[model samples]
Target chain A: MLQSIVHVCLAGLSQGMFIWLVASGLTLIFGVLGVLNFAHGSFYMLGAYFCFMVLRALGENFWWGLLLGPVCVAAVGYLVERFFLRRVYGLELPYQLLLTFAFVLLFDDLVKIFWGAASIGTPPAPGLADSIMILGRRFPSYNLFVIAVGPLLALGLWGLLEKTWAGRIIRASSSDREMASALGVKVPTLFTAVFVFGTWLGALGGGLAVPYLGLLTPGMGEQIIIEAFVVAVIGGLGSLKGAFLGALVIGLLSAFGTRFLPTFDMFLTFILMAGVLLWRPQGFFGEAR
Target chain B: MSKKGMNRRQFVKAGLMTAAAAALGPAVLKPTSLWAAESKVKGPIKLGYQTVLSGTLAGYGEFHKMGAIMAMEEINTAGGIAGNKLEIEFRDSTLKAPDAIQNARYFVDSWGADFLAGIDSSGQALALAPVMAELDRVLMVTHAATEKLTEEQVFKNGVKQIFRIVTPTYQDGNAAAFVAKDLPVKTWATINPKYEYGFTCWNMFKETLSALKKDVTFTAESWAPFGTTDFRSHINTIMDAKPEGLYSVEWAGELITMVKQGIQAGLFNQVKHVMFPVGAAMDVLEGLGAEMPDNIWISGRYYFLYPNDKSNNDWVERFHKRWQHYPAYVSEGAYSTMYAFKKAVEAAGSKETKAVVGALEGMTLDSPAGKRVFRKEDHQAMYDVPWGLTVSNPKYPFKIMGKQVMVPAKDCFARPPFEGPGTKPPFKA
Candidate 1:
């Protein structure tokens, strides 16, 4: 009984962490910027494709791909905020969604044009390709790498937001944009920077996923984005803490659901999201309006 | 009065002209060549082709386009069928049955398509069956492999307008079982696509294998939904089942991910025998490259290297030269389907739907996949596709088959009137 429990948890934890990596950027963007960027998923896809390209250019050097792939996404995010998203800051939610959705279609086609329709997957990280026996179940070390990275990123983000002056200004703008503007916060530029940072986080998740999933596809972003949205919703849409815990819960629920009730596995995540919203309408961490 | 009705003299003159032309035209137009022989056949035969073009499976559509367009150009360059120029319009089916039906309607009613080809999803193909009957246009299904399209929709329902260029579940399941019965395996498990194609293939294999060997047992099953990126959980399920053999029906990009993940989970080390119904597909082999583990039995609707005949070899060379890549089975099926249309039109001596359907039944054509006979009963093309063990070849970048075993189509295909339960077998085990 214990062995099965541990195995399920391991699977859930790894899956959840991967999702957290994507959801972190989403939660951060929505929290500070109040922009529900639908293209966040596209950013994740670009990260995987760029990383795969870099790996190929460097003869499959995975670390180089990991470090450089998300950096490229940061550059893309910068272009998006400076030119496109900058125009939509004062608009309503639907306008922002429509604008970001355009990027989703654009980026999906761009990836296809540049890389072709077939998938190109990265090799497992150096020395992390081995499997460890976990309670009589063989679990991949690459999965463990992903699991470890998720919490580390969460800690890094927590420190960056809570421990720095830039973080304070960003928080001030997020809470009261006019007051921060009056106090010389340069809110527009700050918003751009935050958006870029969030994009980088989403891309980092994509980079991590290349090895974990063992393949990069054009619309993989669309799939992961749906999962991230569920995580963000359950964790409270704009709450980082909520996203972190929510990812874990969603991941574990999906894993256990597949193991125990295979037929209902598809609905388990959505069902959890609905139940959580009914009980704590603001999610676990979102402030009550 | 003259504008509204034909005058007596005008009607008499038209009748005399028609009779004179009919008497003299046959003697003047001598068809020494097949195209010249059928002077009555029309010009500019229009074909509408549709397949998935926007999703992760978009690569399949690209391959379909390559083969169909290549054949169109070739037929046109050689003076076309029965003196008619071949023209083709390509559309994206987008993995939806409704979209496929809409495209079929537009192809026939709007684009004036005389014939159609290229459907990648079995759901889309099965959905288009009744629509084809309604439109009264012949649809040559290239990639979809559901047996129900042939058995239930075509054979049982008498949807004569639908014909498939690719082999159906008979090859994937029954032929696969014929190969497995000799492998000394008693128990099996499967991870299949969670759709009609998956369920049908598994059931077909189980029924045939059980009938062939009474002692064989199926231990467990996992059905992965379409577009499933993560397959580790499914892999674990198969591992726990611990069957003597594993059979996976995953294909294309999904299969690539499954194999890579399965290798990481040490699936190859645990299972002594494994089989992939569509593992020999070009994209999977090319995507995995050196990562693909050897000795797993694999087969597809068509293998580019099989048949090893002069005609097939020559065509593969031309195809590689043109596209700079080897042909996938869809491309082969699509390419052959265009030629099949040409043959039918020439045989029937017209581009009419009823004539073409009649011409296609029991017709044989030499293709890159060898001789394909459009069976008279169901219109499903019957041909030999061999099951081979994966092995690395120095000449090719990916793994090629090492040893291949072929069960003759006569031995494996379900017999006539192909009903679900009552269908007879071509030969007793």
Candidate 2:
């Protein structure tokens, strides 16, 4: 019984970590930019597909994919922010949303055209293909690698945002865009970089996920986007810290809900979202309006 | 203004006309029958086909199109059906029920399709039953495998316009049980799709397995929702229960994910006996390729290599040469359906709906999947599909079934009424 509980918890943790990889990027972009980039999930999907390309090129080394897949996605993010997203920065939220939503449809169709509508199998990470014994139960090592990396990346992001000068400029621009521009900061360039950084995070999650989930399909990002929004909203939109914890909470709830109360599995996430909305409207870390 | 515009009396007349339309039919409007009454049933015999054309299972649509078009080409080359030039129009039916229903109507009403074929989902097939009856167009269901489409929709409910070319859950559930009962396993667990097809198959397997074996118990079950990318939690649940055998009815892309993840989590290592009802599908086999674990049992509606007959083998070679890919069950079924139409229409000597249906009722046709007889009772094609263990064959790139077991259809398929345990060999669990 204890072992089963441990298994569920471990499974939930890995699931949460995967969601965090996607949610972290979404939180950073939505929190800082006040633009609900619906295409953030598309970025996550592109990460997986791009990672597959690299993995196909470089063999099944997990590190090669992690190193290069997000870089490609970051390039995409850079272009999107510079040409398209740049036009809608100060525009109304609906305009930004409409543009991102259009990209979602475009990207999904583009993937189908390029990759075809069939599912593709991804090889496991080179050495972590085997399951290790945990609590007298076998668990996937690829999952363990993800769980470990989720927090490490969170810490790395924290150090970058808190200690670095570039991070300070980003904070300044996001909090007070006019003040930063008046102080001679290249605000548009900073926004582009920040968007690129967030894109990288989402892509990184997708790259890691290719080996973990071991499959890719078109419209795969659509489902994750809904869950990530729930996590982001619950964690207090834009709060990186909030996304991390919220991902864990959502993941565990999904796992347990599917197991114990299978009927409520679909509604449980929304119920939590509704509860959060009724009580803490600003989210776990958002500033009160 | 008074001459052009409506007065109170004119407005009331228009309102009455609107209310008449509203008060007419309780459900579906019956204009399809009048449209069918006007159908010329002459010149070219047009067939409208639709399948999952743009999602994860979009490959299925490709396969369906390949087979149907191939068959259409062959027929047109051979002077067409009933001395008329056979014409076909393709539409994306999508996964939704309403879309499928609309497509079926469009095929008959607007597109002037004499015949309709290739439905992918059982939900869509069931939804189209009454609509097909209203349309009076003979629909040959190629992919959807829910038995209810045949038994309930066609037989019980008297929705006779529907006929299934593909073998339904009988092969997946009861025939699987008949094969599994001889094995030593006792405890079984299942993870299946969350919809009607999944539920019916699982129940059929459990019911038939229980009847066949005295001691077997269903230990655990996990239902995977549509578009489930992860099965780790379901895996955990099954492992916790520690069943002797795991039977998963997950098909296509989802099955590929489940198996790949199963290998990673060592689920296959712990559970010695694993059976995938539709694991032998072309998409699953091609996707998994060399990594598909050996000795795992798999079955589908039809396999390319089965029958081991000259016609079947010759058909397989031709299909590969044409499409550069082996035929999936849907492909074979779709191909067979086209031939069935030819035989029916030629035998009837008319493209009329009633005449073709009459000829098709108990018609036997020779095709790639061997001889298929559409059961007059429920319009289900009674055919053989084998269950076998996966093994790498030198002739093929992907894993092929080795040591195949062919269970006779009569031993597993339900009797005429198909009501319950009292009426059939395999019943609801």
Candidate 3:
């Protein structure tokens, strides 16, 4: 019984990391730009498809995809912001949403046109596919990797944001955007850079997720985007720290709900989000700004 | 004169020209006019098919439409029923029930379709059910497998014209039950989408298990909303429960996602037996590839590997050659339903709605999955439901079933009282 609890926790932590990867970017982009990129999950989906295509073209070496896929996705994100998003800069939220939603449809069908309607899934890395001993039972090694990497990435991002000039500028802008702009921060260029950076994080999440989740399909973007919204809202929109904390709470709640109330398991994530909203309208770690 | 008089004047001018052609010869004139008359079969027999061409279940809709088209072509080539050529028209409702009902009305009343059929979801069927009666049209239901369509919620007025060829949802649930009971598992956890069909299957399976074994317990269960992409949490929960058995009623892409995530999370390793009600689909197995582990029992409405008869094999080959994709269960059901419709039309000796319905009610037809006969009681087809375990074979690129069982319709179905009050059930009995 005790063994099963540990297993569940490990699996939940692994999943929480993946959620954090995508949701943190969501939080960062929203926090800085005051624009919710509805196509963020579309970017994530693109990352998976890009990785899959690159792997097949360049041979099935997971390492190459892990390094290069996000870079390529980041480049695309940069182009997407420079060309298309720039047009919608001063527009209403609905206009931004509509444009991003259109992109979602476009990218989804594009995946279908390229990969067909069937799912594209790859096996886990051979060595990490098997389970390692945990709590006297075996749990997947890949899950352990995910659990370990999530906090490391969070800490790394925190360090970069706090310690570096670029990080200080971003932090300053998060507090006082007008002041940061007046201080020669090149706010427009910074917004574009931040957009690319956040999209890269999302893409990296998608690329790394292929081996763990297995299949990436057309409508997956739509599903992920909704969940990302839920996570971002629950964690306090525009707060990276909030997203990180929210992902953990939602992930654990989902896992625990599944364990205890398997039938209502799917609703747990949303239920937790609802509970958090009722408690804190500004989100746990988010400020009014 | 009315607007109709202008069109009549134009026709008379053309006729005057044909009269001039009579000067050439009586033979040439008669032959030309007869050829013209024969060449055009008056407007063709319009059949309406409603499907989900652009949603989560689009794959199912696409394949079913392909099968329906194939059948329509074959019927048209064979000089369609009672010397009337077949014309099919399709509308996409995006798989939503209200949209489907609206489309159903449009096809029958506005589009002037003489016959109606085709739907991908049971919810759509329910929405269209009452309207079918109000419209008083014959709808040959093809792909959707909800038992309620033919049972509690059947079209009240158009019951006679509404004929279902596909087996009910419970047929699938019953097959899962039989397979699960045969296995060595004691405790089970079910993961199904939260909807009628999903609930029905889960309930039927639990009921069957309870009836079969007194001590079986369900340790955990999960009902994810339809179109849910993530299964990580559900996987963790199932692992925590550590049940010996797992049954998932999820189909198509959702099932594919669940299998991949479940395998990665090591949930399958924790359980001794897993029963995926619709996971035996070829597309899903091929997509999963190495992720599709061994000893997982799965069930589908049809298995292309079954029947192995020369004719069925030839059909399979021809279908593959044409589509380059393996036939899914829904596709097979569509094909077989068309064949059943053909057989029923022949038996009735007329395309009159009631006659066709009568002929189909208590008739049997051969299909790729052996012979299926519609039970006179509920209009549900009595055929062998295919169930088996996923066995990876080098002979095929995808996972194929081994230890396959053919649970007859008798085992997988129950007698129908259908609706509480019915003037005449869709079934003849």
Candidate 4:
């Protein structure tokens, strides 16, 4: 029983890490831009597809995909922010929402045209396919790698945000956009940079997740986007720390729920979201407007 | 103000007449015009094909379209159905129930389709089944496999317009049980998508298996929402239960994900037997190629290399020649449905909807899947269910079924004339 509990916890933690990776990006973008960026999930999908294409074309280590997939997605993100998103900065929230949602449909069709409608699978990276014995039971090494990534990324992001001048500028701008611009922070350029970085984070999550999930399908982004949104909301919109916590809560709930209450697994996440909304509308870490 | 100027009462009367005309004009004129135009069935017999043209299930729809296209081309080339050229108008359902119903109506009302066919999801099939009766049109369901469409919805709802070319889920479940009884598996667990088809599949398999093997126990059950991308937690939960065998009803992309993740988690290492009723689909094999493990049991509605008959082999060759990829069951279902429609039309000696429905009730026709008989009682096809073990064959790039087990339709199918456990007479009568 104890071992089973341990297994569930480990599975939950690893799953949470992936959710955190996605939710963090969404939260970050919302925090700085005050736009929901519904296409955040599309970037993640592109990451997976791009990584798969790279791996298929250049037969080498999986590292190639990890290194280049996010870069490609980041470039696309940069262009999207510079051209389309730039126009919507001063518009109503609905326009920004509608514009981002349009990107979702556009990318969905684009993926179908390029990748075809069939799902594609990538083989496990070399040396990561096997399982290792843990707590007298076998656990996938790939999941361990996934679990480790969340904390590593969180620490890196913390350092960048807290210690560096660029991070300081970004923080200042997000908090006081008018003041930052008055102080010569190049507000438009900073917004673009932040959007691109957030997109890269989403893409990185997708690339990292594809090998473990083992299949990539068009509209896969839409499936995960809702869960990511729930996490972002529960953790407090735009709060990176809250996103992590929310992901963990949802992931663990999913894992344990499957064991104890198989029928309500899908509803469990929503129930939590509802509870959070009822109790704390702004979210755990969110600031009042 | 002279003879042209109107009094206040006269002006009010003219305004009311104009408002009435504006409100009722289209409703009265549109249908009459459409009926007048559509009543003349002069040139070709049109079939309205509705299925998922986008999303994860698109492959099934694509294959269905391919198979239907091939059949239409052949028939058109060799003197079309009853001297009239057969053509299909395709519509994307997007795999939603509302969209499928809307598409079905559009096909019948707007395009004047002689018949409606093609549905990838069972839910769509169930939703559209009732609509067929409302439209007073015959709908040949090509791919959706829910037993409820024929067993409950057809008989209980008095829906005679719907007929399924694919084997019902109940029959497949019974076949699965037969295969399970022969194997060395004892304790069984199931992981299926949470939906009508999945639940019905699991229940039928379990009930039939329990009847066959008195000692068999179902240790664990897991239900994942449809189109779920992650199955790690589900996998861990199943592994913890440690069932000797697993039955998974997940199909297409979701199945690919589960199998691959199962391998990574070493779940297969612990479980002795695993069966995927729809896993032998060409798309699944092609997607997983070389990574698909050997000895795992899989079943398909139709396999390209099965029946080992000459005519079946010829059809396979012809399909491969044109499409370059082996046809999945959905493809065969669509192909056979077109031929079935042709046979029924020829038998009835008319393309009228009521006549076609009557002819199709107990029709027996030759298809690529060998001979199929649509039961008069329920309108469900009675055909062989093919199951096999996955083996790496040298001739094919992907894994092919080896040591094939052909479950005879006689043993698997329910008795006819609304005699099944869940079947009932129409409440209206």
Find the candidate with the highest DockQ and give its number.
4
Pairwise TM-score winner, candidates 1 and 4? 1
Off by over 4 Å in 1: A1-3, B1-39, B420-426
Model 4 chain A weakest 10-residue run by lDDT: A54-63
Q: Give the Cα lDDT of each candidate.
A: 0.87, 0.86, 0.74, 0.84
Model 4 CA deviation exceeding 4 Å by range = B1-41, B418-429
Tens digit of lDDT per residue, candidate 2, span B58-100?
Answer: 7788889989999999999998886778888999887899889
lDDT of 4 by residue, A1-289 (tens): 8878888888889888888999989999998988899999999899988888877777845668878988899999999999999999999988898999999989988998998877777878767878898877777898899899899999898889889999899889999999999999999998999999999999999899778788788888887788899999999998998998999998899888887788788888899899989989888898866
Pairs of colliding residues, candidate 1: B31-B36, B31-B37
Return whichever of 3 and 4 wins on DockQ: 4
Taking the tens digit of each residue's C-alpha lDDT, what string does model 1 give over B170-190?
888998898889887899999
Fnat, one value per model: 0.48, 0.58, 0.46, 0.69
Q: Please give the lDDT score at residue B53 for candidate 2.
A: 83
DockQ versus reference, model 3? 0.33
TM-score of chain A of each: 0.97, 0.97, 0.95, 0.98
The top-ranked prediction according to lDDT is 1
Tens digit per residue, CA lDDT, model 3, A32-143: 8877888888888888878777777777877677778888889988988899988987988888878877887787777777777656667565467776777766566877
Model 2 stretches with alpha carbons more than 4 Å out: A60-62, A90-92, B1-41, B420-422, B426-429
Superposition TM-score, candidate 1 onto the true structure: 0.92
lDDT of 1 by residue, A41-90 (tens): 99999998888888889888888899999999999999999999999888
Clashing pairs in 4: none
